[model samples]
Target chain A: MEEDPVELVVPEPIPEPTPSAPPEEVEKEEQPAQPTPPAEPTTAAPPQHPFLDRKDFYIPPASRLPEGSELALAKAFLMTQSEKSNLNLYDHLTEVIVRILETRPGNVVDAFETLSADIKRSHFVVDRPNAPGAFQKASEVAPANEIGAAQVKLFEKSGLEEPGDPEAFGEIPDIMDLSNLWEWAGVSLGKEETFMLFLSLKSLVTSKPLQSVRLWGKILGAKANYLIIEGELKEGAVDEDAPQVEEEVQENAEEKKEAEEDEDVPKRKEKPVIPLPREERVGVNKYVYYVCNYAGGPWTRLPDVIPEKLQASRRIRKFFTGDLNHKIVSYPPFNDTEAQYLRCQIARISAATVVSPSGYYTFDQEDENEDEENPQPQNIIINPEFESLSPEQLIDPANWVHHVPYILPQGRVTWENPLGQKGEEEANEDEDEEEGSDAGEGEEERENVEPETGPGILSPLSSDEGP
Target chain B: MSFINLDDLPYLTLVGFTLNTEEKAAIQSSLQVKKEQEKLEEIWLWGKILGVQRDYFIAQATKDNLFSRKFYYSIDLVNWLQLPDVPSSDMDRISQVHGRFTGDPAFEYSLGEEPEEGAEEKTINEEKRLSGTVALINYETEIVPRGAYYRDTLHQLQKNVNFSGIPKGELSQLTHYLHFREGFDINKRTLQERADAFDESIDIFETIANDEPKGVWSCQTERTGSVAILRSLLWPGYVFFHTANPPKWGSMYYGTGQRNLNIGFML
Candidate 1:
C-alpha cells in the first residue's frame, strides 16, 4: 500500500475574543484581575512548548516550512534569511515553494513543537541585555548549502544464514569535505523541485533507522542548511551511526554588519528566504519501500551527543529531547523487494476544482433517486470518468483532495417536468389568486429571494476567543 | 523620516458633489412625503453655497479673506445651475503654461464677463487680467505634519454636527456619523454657542507634526508613481496612506489648488 498522506481541514478561524481588558489596558487600572477565557490547547503536547523542539533537522531562520507549517511560518519568518550565503536567494524561491507545499484541503501541522528558528533568534537577542551582538552577528556570515540526489539502499545482499557484521559496510566519509563525493554543489542558495501528480516518496516514512550511531554521526557533521537526499543512496541505506567530519573552512572571510532597523521603512526587504533539503528518487522498479521525505535542515553542531551548547542553552536541549518529531510508517513485506521503498518523490496536487468560496470539485451519482428527495443528491467520485458507483462505493473521502471547492455544471440541476406544468413560469398571478390573497399583493414583494449562486461565502467572521 | 512619494496621495483634487439631502435613499411613493421631498429637491436645485475643501479650490477671489469666516464652509454643496463651471471644454488644455493669457479680453469674453459684472472694465491698454487673483486660505506647508491639513479641516466644518442626539424615532433612519463630537446640538443648542465652540477648536490641530507631502505635480512626461493618492484628492473608500511618490518639480508650493470653493447650494 502507498504511504498515502492524509489531510484534514477545519473551518476558518474566527477572531479570538478580546480579554476583558487588553494587556495595554491592564497597564492603567489597579482593578482585580478579571478571569478571561483560556486559549484552545495546541496540537503539540503540553509538556512540549511548540517553540523548544530541537531535533537535528533544523529549518534555518529563512527556510520555507515543511509543507504543513508553510503559512504560519510565512508570517513568522517575513524578516529572516534562511541561508548563510549573503546572496539574495530567498527572494528567488520562497513564493514558488509555498505554491509547491500546496496539498489541497489540509491545515498546517505542528511538525516542530517550537516556534520557528528565527523567532527564537529574536527572542534570544531582544530578550537579553549584557550579551554582545556576536550571536546575531555570527549568523550574518552566509551559510553554504549542498544539493545532490538521494542515495537509497537498493538491496543489501540479504544476510542469508549468518550475516557479516552490519557495521563494516563502508567507511563513513567526512560530510563537510565537498571532495569525497561523486557530485556536490556548495553554497547552493535555494532548492526546489517540480512535483508530478500521483508520484511521491514514502520510503523515508517507512525506513526509520534511527538505531544506528553512524548515520547520526554523519548528520551531526554535515555542513549544509538544507541537505537534499536522493533516491540512489536510499537503496543502499546507511546505518544511522555513520561517523562523518565537518568540512574545513577558509578562515578570515569577514562578516558584514547585519541590518539595523529604523522607524519608517518596512524591515521585510532585509531578510533572506531559505531553501529546504530535497531528496530525489527515480525509476524504482520492484521497489520495497513506498515513499518518504527527509528535509535535511540547516547545519547545526548537534548538542544531542555533544551537549555543551545544550548545557548553555536550555532552548537547544529542549529541541532535541522534547520536540523533534520522528515520523515512521510501515507495511507488510511485498514479493517485489526493491519495489517496497521509494525516495525523492514529488507530486502536484491542484486546487482547480476549488470553486468560488475557495478552491472546486463535485460528486456524480446514479439517477435512482430521480423520484425521491426534493433536491436530488450528486455523488462525489474519485476519477472524472464518472463511472456510476453504489452510494456506498464512492471514492474514499480520505484521498478526495479538496484543493478547492466543487464547481461546474458537473452537479445535477432538477428540471421541471414538462408534462406537469405548461405555464409554471407565469403561474404567479394564478397562484396568488388561487391562494386567495389580496389584489395589491399579487406582484412579487420587494424582497425577491434569489437561488444561491456563485461560491458559497465562507464566513469571514473571526473566531470568537470565547462565548 | 521616510520621504513622501507622489504615488501616495489619492488624487490632486476631490470634487465631491454633496446632495443637499440624503446621500443614499430607498425609493418610496407616499404623496405627502413626496411633496415635502419635492420642495427640498427644488430648493436643492439652486441650493445655497457652502464651501470647498478649503480656499484651495477657488480659482479666483472674493472681497474677504482674513475677515471672512470661510472655514465654516469647509465642504460646500453648490447648486450646479448657480455657479458656472470653467464653461469651456478646454480647461485641461488651459493649465498654467499659457495661463498668462488668462487676463486677455478673449479670456474675459469666454467667461461671459467682458462687460465686467463685479469687476471693472480695463482700458484698452490695461492688463486684461484683473490686478491679481488671491487665494482664500494661504497654508504654509512644510515637511512636518500640519495637523489641520491632514485632518482635512475644511471638509470637517461642512459636516452637519448640530444634531441634538437625533430624535428617538430617527434612530432607524440613520446612525450618528462623525467620530469626534461636533460642537452644535442642532436646534436644542444655541447657534451662537455652537459657532463659538467650533471656531475655538478650528485652529487647534492646524499644524501638521508629521508632514508628508501631498498632491500631484504631474504634467504627463514625468508621472507620479502612486496614482491612488495623487494630489490631496482621496481615493474612494481608502482612508489611510502608507506610501507616497517622491517630490519631483518642487518641494512644497503653496498654490491656487488649496483655495476654498463655496459650497452649500448657490441659487
Candidate 2:
C-alpha cells in the first residue's frame, strides 16, 4: 500500500514559477492522501522547475520546511527590488520589527508611525525637504570629523602643547642633550630614565612659561623615588611672595616665638631689615624645583626654602619617604615636611658644590662702580671673554670656584637679614667674636671671612679647612 | 682616594647616599695625606654603612698584597680609625648578632643566652662585627671583570694596567665577571666543565656565573649603554658600576648592612 502511494506521489508534477508560495499550499496539493512516512521519498526528489537552481531562492519540500521559512521567503522577496538600488531594506525592516516587539503596541501600525515621528524629532535621520527619495542632511553624514576637531580644540585649550615640532616654537633646547654632558662627568640617570624624563620635562615646559629646564637629580626615598626637574621661570612668571612660602615663614616664626618663650629669653626689638644682596633669580633660589613620584607623574612645585629650615636640614640626616607631607621627627624638629627639607638640601648642595670652569662666570664689575659706603652686592654674570681651561687645571679642585654664595651657618649668605631679630643677630655676632679670639684657629677665621668677601674662588688652601 | 673623586661621587647618589662637597673634599684630602704618611699600596673609599646616630665612612687599603687589605672607618671625616682584626672563630659569633648599628663603636651585643642564667653568653663589640661583616660581604659578592687582574711571575696577583675593560656588550653577562676573592677549587667542577678553561695562576677565583641560588646578581647597562650597573640581590643595597671606554669602575654600599637572608625563598 505504501509503494502505491509513493509511486503516485512521485509521478505528479507541480509547475510553479514563484519560490515564495506558502508551504501549506504546496502541502495541501502534493500530499492529499499519503501518510508522512510514505510521502518522504517523493518529497526528497529534486524540484522540476529551473528557478530552484538558485540555492537561496529554492523552496524546501513542504513537510521538511523549517519554522519561519515562509515569513523569511516573503521578506527576501520584498527586499529584492531595494537590493539593486543601494538601500538597506534588511536592516530597516529588522529594526522596525525589533521596535514593534519591544513596544508591543495595542495597534502594530501605530508603533511604526510613532517610531518614525520620534526619529524625526530627535534628528537621528535628518531629512532634506527639497531632495528626492528622502535624502539625509549633510550634517549627519560626517559626525566623526566634527568630533575629532572638537578633541583637537580641547587639547589646545588645555595648554598641553605637543613637543618636538620646531616650527611652532623655534628650536627649543632638548633636555636629553644634558644626559651627554652629565655622563661626561660620570653622572647619569641611565638611558631609559633620561629619555622618560626628557619627554616629561618637555610637557612641563609647555604647561608653564619656562625659559629652560633640566633634570636636577633623583632623590631616592623609602617607598618610591622622586624625579626632580629644575626650571627657570619666564621673566614675569615668578611669584615673588609665593603663598606656600608665606605660610611656611609664618609657621616658622610662631615656632620660634614658642621656643623663645619656653627658654624665658627677653624679647628684643626688630632690627632694620637688610636688603638682600641680589635678587632670588641670581643666587640660591635661581631655579624653581618640581618633583614627581615617577618620570611621567604629575609634578609638584616645592615650597621656597627658608634660612631656619636650611640650617635645621644641615643638622639632621634623613632619607625622604617620597611623600611631600611626611613629617620629619628628629631632635631638632624640621618645621616643614619633606618638601621643604628637600628644598633646603638642594639649596645647600647648589650653594656649596655647583661649580663652573673658572672663566665661565665673572664678577659683575658694574657693581664695583657703585659707592663703597653702600656697595651693591656683586652679581656673577656669564663671561663673554670665557676661555676654556686646560684639562689639567679643570680636573683640579682649586680651579672649580663656586658661582653661588656659601650659605652661612646663619642660613643667609650674610648675617644682615633685615627681616631677622636683633637677638639672633647679636648671638651670631658673639659667636663670630669668640671664633675671632681663637688665634690658633686660622681655618675657622678664613671660613668666616670667605662669605663676606663675596664668592670664594676655591684655593688649594681652602680644601684643608675642615668643619 | 683618587679612584673616588667628585666626578665619581655622583654615582653614589644613584644608590642614595651622598657626602656633601665639604665632606667629600675633606675625605679626599685627608685620605691622600693618610696614604702618603702610611706608604700604603692603594686606598679607596669602601662605602658608608648607616648607623642609628651617625653613618660610618669606610675606607679600604692594601698594604703589601690584596689579601692583606685593611679597613678603616670614621664617624667624623677628619679621623680614620682602623677596625680591629677579627679572628675566624669570632666570625661565627658575629653572624648571630643582627640589628642596626648603634653608631657607637663600643656598643656590645650579647649572644646566645642571658649572663645571669647558667648558660654562657658571649659578648661582641659593634666594631668587630662591622669589620667581619664587611669582610664577609666582600668575599661573597665583590666581583671584577675576569682580566682585571692576572698572576705575576712570582704568582702574586697584580692589577693589569693594560686591561682596557670588559667590552660593553659582554658587561651584562654574568660569565664575564669573577669574584675578587681568593680560593677557587677546580675539583668541584665536572671534568667536562674544566676541560679547556682551567688555569691555576690566572683563574684564582670562582666565576659569579656559578653562584648558587640563581638570580643573585642583576647586571644592567646604564648611561646610554656606556656604563654597566650591577646590583647584588643577595645584598640589597650594594651596587657596582663600570664604564668601558674610559675604563672607570667603583662600588658603594648604601644599605642597612644586613644580608638578604630570605634570598633563597625569594628566588
Candidate 3:
C-alpha cells in the first residue's frame, strides 16, 4: 500500500480588486501607492541608521519563489518569534490542529495527512515527561492556546507528556520493538476497523510478549476516546476465574439463582459461557490479556477533549487478557481474524520447532481414516513434485531457506563476551589450584609417600584434613 | 536387584523389626513351596513380619529378575498359604515406607477411610488370584506442591531418571516423589477401590504413567512406540496437575479444562 504525502493547506482563492476608473486611473493609483509608501518611510527614517531606508524596507524578490520556499522561511521566522514569547511548542501545534478541524470536512486521506504532518511538526519540540502518569484519562478540556502555555501547564500538572518523536533522528524508526513499551502513530477508524487492528496486534503478540503498547486512535462517530488494549503479558498470572466484566458476572449469578428456582426449562444464552478466542488452541496456563478502557458508541458522552489530547491522560480503566475481550471481537468462519489466529499459531510453533529435510508426514495417506471413495482434504491439495527429484536433491538446504524467518539461529545471539570469559578462566584457575593442593604433595611425591604396608593396613586417623 | 540384601537387615532392625528363627524358617519354606508349585523360578525374600497369630512374609520372584518386574507374594507362616501377588498389600507397604521418609504422618493403609482394625479372614478368591493372576497396584498418589525441591526435581526429571543403584526399600520415596512431581496422585488404597465406590474408572495415572520420571519409573509396557508426556508447565508459578491420555496437543477437538484442573493433595 502506497502512503500519501503530507498535504499542505490550499489557501483560499483571493478575490480580484475591481479596476477603479480606467487603466490610466489604475496606473495613477498604483504610482501614488508606491511613491507615498517611499515618501512616508523617507520622512520618518533616521539618518543615523541608513540600513533602515525606505528602499531597504521592501522584502526581496527572492522570497517570492513559487516552490513555497517562502513558507519554510516564514515557519523559521515564526519559530524564532515564538522562542521570544511564552508560547509552548505543543500548544501551538494543538491550536493549528483545532483550526484545521474547524474547516469543513473534505477528503479523509487529506485530513489524515494534514493531521499527521502537524503532529510530526509538534512532536519535534514536545517536552519529555519526568515521571509516568497515573493510569487515568484527563476529563477537562482547557481553552486552545495559540502559544502552547495551557498545554504545557496541563502537562506540568499531570506530570506526563506524549511519547518521544523518532523523526528527531532524521530517519524513519524501525518497527516498534515488541519487547519494549512502544508507541504507534494514532489513527481514527470505525469500530470495525479498530477491532481488526486489535486482532492484528493480538496476532503479533501471540508469538512474542508485547510488554506494553499505547495506540491512541479515535473511533468514528463516537465523542469519547475509545481505548482497547491487550494488557501486559506477565508470566504465571492466570486470569480471574470468572468473567471480569461486571455485567456478565451479574448475568451469570442471576441465571444460576433462577436455575435453582426452576427445574425443567433451560434458559438459552443465559449465563452463556462466552468462549475465549484461541483459549483452546493456546496452552491452559498461557497468560495473554487485554482491556477496553472506553467502549464508545452513538450514545457516548461528547467529551470536550480531543483524541490527541486525551492520549496524554494516564487513565487505564481496566486490566484484562485477550480472552476477556474475545467476547467483543467476532471471529467469523474463514475470515482474516481466523487466518491471523492460525498464522500466529504457526509462527509460535515454527519458532519452537526445527524443520528438517529428512522430515516427512508422520502418518501416510493410508493411515488417514477418511473414506477412499470420498474427496480427501489432503488429496485436494497438490503435493510438491518429489518423485522426479533425486535423494540428494530432496535434502537440499536451498529448498528450506523460506523457513529462516520462523526460527532464529543460535549463532545470531551467541556473541562471545571477553569479560565473562575472563571471569570464568579465573574461577577455573582457582579450581585447578584447589585440586593441586588436594592431590597431597605431588604425583611423584605421592608415589614415594605411599603407605609402607599393603592395602587395609593403615596407621588409622591422623591429625590432618585428609586422615 | 533382590528385594532385600543381607546388609539391609541392620537397617530393618533400626526400623523396629526383627526376624525370629522360626519365622525365618517359615519364610524360607514358603519360598520353596512357591518355587515348586509355580513351575519353578528364582525368588527373593523381600520382607518378613511376625503378626499376632501368623507371620506375614513377602517374596519377590521373576523369570529373570534382571529387569524391574511387578511380581511378589504375601505368605502366612502358619498355613504356608503361598499367595503369589500381594494386591493392595504391596501398595500399603510402599505407602508406609514413603510416608516415614517424607514425614507425612497422615499416610495410612487406606485412602481417607480408616482401615478395619480386627483380624479378617482372607477370601479364597483373593488367594487364588494372588498365586498366579496379574496383580494391579493402582492407587492415587499425592503431588508435591511447587515448592522446595519442585524446580530441582523438574530440572532433573527433564533428563533421564535412572534408579539403577537405588535400594528397593527406598524405591517408594523416589517413585512417589517422581510420580507426584510429574502430577500423579498417590495413596495407599488402589484406584480400583476408589473406582468401585465411585462406579467409574478414575485412573488418570495411566495417561502419564508411561513417562518414567527422569527414568526412575519402571515401565510395565516394554516396547511399543512411547508417547511423550505433555509438559503443562507454561509458566513458573502456574501449575497444571492433570494431563490427558494420548497427550492432547495441536488437536482439533477440545477437551474440558475443568477436568484437567487438579483436585488432589498438594505437597
Alpha carbon lDDT of residue A55, candidate 1? Answer: 19
Per-residue C-alpha lDDT of model 3 across residues B1-267, encoded as one tens digit per residue: 224433323222211133444555666676677677776566665443222233234455655323334444353453334444445655343333211111121222233344467844322232332222222211222122111122232223221122122111221222222223234343544887555532121222223233323322211100011111111211111111111122111100001111111111100
Query: Which candidate should be chosen as best, given DockQ against the real structure?
Result: 2
TM-score of chain B of each: 0.19, 0.90, 0.32
For model 3, the stretches where C-alpha displacement exceeds 4 angstroms are A1-232, A236-253, A256-467, B1-267
For model 2, residues B1-267, the per-residue Cα lDDT tens digits are: 113444676555455345555667788888887788778877788877888787788888886677778788988887888888999999998888877888899989888676877756789999999999888778877887777778888978888788787665456677767888877776787887777776655566788888887777766554434556677777776777776676777777766688877665433
Q: Select the stronger candidate by DockQ from 1 and 2.
A: 2
How would the docking of model 2 be graded?
A: incorrect
Pull out the clashing pairs in model 2.
A273-A418, A274-A418
Lowest summed lDDT window (length 10), candidate 3 chain A = A455-464
lDDT of 3 by residue, A102-171 (tens): 4536674567667756644533232433323322221111111111342233335334533454322122
lDDT against the true structure, per candidate, is 0.22, 0.63, 0.29
Per-residue lDDT of model 1, residues A1-467, tens digit only: 11211112121322211222233333222111111001113322224334322212233333222234564355235323434432122221322222223332244344322223332332222334335442322211111112112211111112122444544332332332322121121111111211110111222322333221112111110111112222223345653422121111111111111122224333225421111111122111111121212222222111111111111221111101011222212122111111111111111001122212111234345535444322434333344443444445333332223422212111112222211233354334434544444322333321232222222212111211121
Tens-digit lDDT string for candidate 1 (B29-120): 12224335333321111111211222111111112221121111111222111122232333322222222222122233233236557766
Encode model 2's per-residue lDDT on A40-148: one tens digit a residue: 3566654455443222243345544343878557745644533233333433443354445445678778567777555334322224455544532333213323433
Candidate 1 stretches with Cα past 4 Å from truth are: A1-467, B1-10, B13-267
**Candidate 1, lDDT over the whole model:** 0.22
Instruction: Assign candidate 1 its CAPRI class.
Output: incorrect
- The CAPRI category of model 3 is incorrect
